[model samples]
Target: MVAIDPEPLLAAGRLAHEQLMNDACTITRVGPPTLTRGTSVLTPGASTTLYSGACRVKPQRIPRNEQASERLTVVARYEVALPFSSVATDDLQVGDTVTITASGDTRLVGQKFAVMAVDFGSHSTAWRLTVEGAT
Candidate 1:
């Protein structure tokens, strides 16, 4: 009986994933918000950049619209994939924010998203993040 090593396969997968990513993204860990008069204020204390590099951003779902009176709200969901070695698996949190600094699609650039979930596994070639934002 022989045991085959999986490192080579994993390395190849990582390389392929990196080559497909055409966008630049930045992940930021935001500081705790301040509470004032029983309300949470979004005044950011300090932020740390967890990762900044090439990434792939894909639309998870079509933008949905909700109308209230004369105001309309549109919500968009996206999935971001980063190279396996882009950042440590434990460094990203659910509440962390991802900003797409540059992308081949002009509409995607300068868009910010709130991280809703992080997906990773031993065999994962890239880190997948589910994010949502108002379009």
Candidate 2:
């Protein structure tokens, strides 16, 4: 039996998958915070733009009781998926932030989320990120 290279298949799959990623998001890597005197300051290092382009953002299905009391609580979590060509995986780290710059759903625009985890696979079409909403 002859062997078939998976590169072509992967490429085609990514192309088709990326089309569904209609949302536009900007991923920014934030530096660690510093402390002045006895108080901790949130003066993170110079923010860097890691990735900014088409992506998919979806809220994870969780129990209602797990959510906060308020409807628009900052504790909400979401999963973000971006095309592989759009970002270098190494540039994305935990604590980085993702902001929805544009989306067909107006409600998603301007929302910010902190990266909690990164998920990728050999056969994956897009990189998945678990993020929590910020206030």
Candidate 3:
């Protein structure tokens, strides 16, 4: 499923897809639905939640003692690139569940911001996401 802006300039991206235009990650928010980052056919200025198949999920089953300083291992469900900046920080842990949808070949990686926000250019992305709730 892709999201299209109520207007008529966006590309209407496809959800649940794996695209690698840049290293950044695009995403779909919870409400007001805003494609903060990445690229999409949906309205460029209309707030919305865009979906894409670009996520970083890790399964961490470490003991309590090892939780202090252990890195989580992640895998990409699809052969696609998410949208974002150089850094991504979120509370999502391993074994969490997430969903990705899209309207085009754009992608974004995010898991902490309730409100999505991209650069001045809709194409600027450079972040990764770690969504939880999936085993």
Candidate 4:
């Protein structure tokens, strides 16, 4: 019996996955201390670009209003997937915002989504992020 090496197969799978992540998405970290203004006051943190690369973004279902008096609002929820090499699990937080742009058009840019959940796949295969519209 002969054992075949699996390196080539894994490489091919990684290549194919990368090709599908053609869309661009930026993950910005907004929670780190920037400067100290006074003895006890710390200035608001600045937006730091954590990850910027190709990703797959899909719009999740919007919740339906149950009552007529309640104003119906579309809460844009999205599932974003990116190569595991692009970002570390600890790099993203719940309040981080992911801005997505389509085909270099600003008009079609989706709403800024706040990170609700971060799913870091085992073995670092990928990162699946569940995000919702920032209120």
Best by lDDT, which number? Answer: 1
Among residues 3 or more apart in sequence or in different chains, the pairs in candidate 2 whose N, CA or C atoms overlap within 3 Å are: none
Better of 2 and 3 by lDDT: 2
lDDT (tens digit, per residue) of candidate 4 on 9-47: 766766777777767888898666766556767677788
In model 1, the clashing pairs are: none
TM-score of predicted structure 3: 0.23
- Residue by residue across 57-86, what tens digits does model 2's lDDT show? 988855233346655543677889999777
Q: Write the per-residue lDDT of candidate 3 for residues 1-135, one digit (tens) a residue.
A: 898654233322312122334233344333334563567545434433354334433323332322225755332233223434323323322322234332243433333322222214353232333233211
lDDT of each: 0.89, 0.83, 0.33, 0.71
- By summed lDDT, which 10 consecutive residues of candidate 3 come out lowest? 110-119
Kindly list the per-residue Cα lDDT of model 1 for residues 2-99, writing each as its tens digit.
Answer: 99999999999999999999999999997876657566555656898999989999999998998989989898999999988864546788989899
Among all candidates shown, the one with the greatest TM-score: 1
RMSD of 1: 3.0
Q: Which run of 10 residues does model 1 get worst, by summed lDDT?
A: 35-44
Off by over 4 Å in 4: 1-9, 32-43, 62-71, 87-90, 103-110
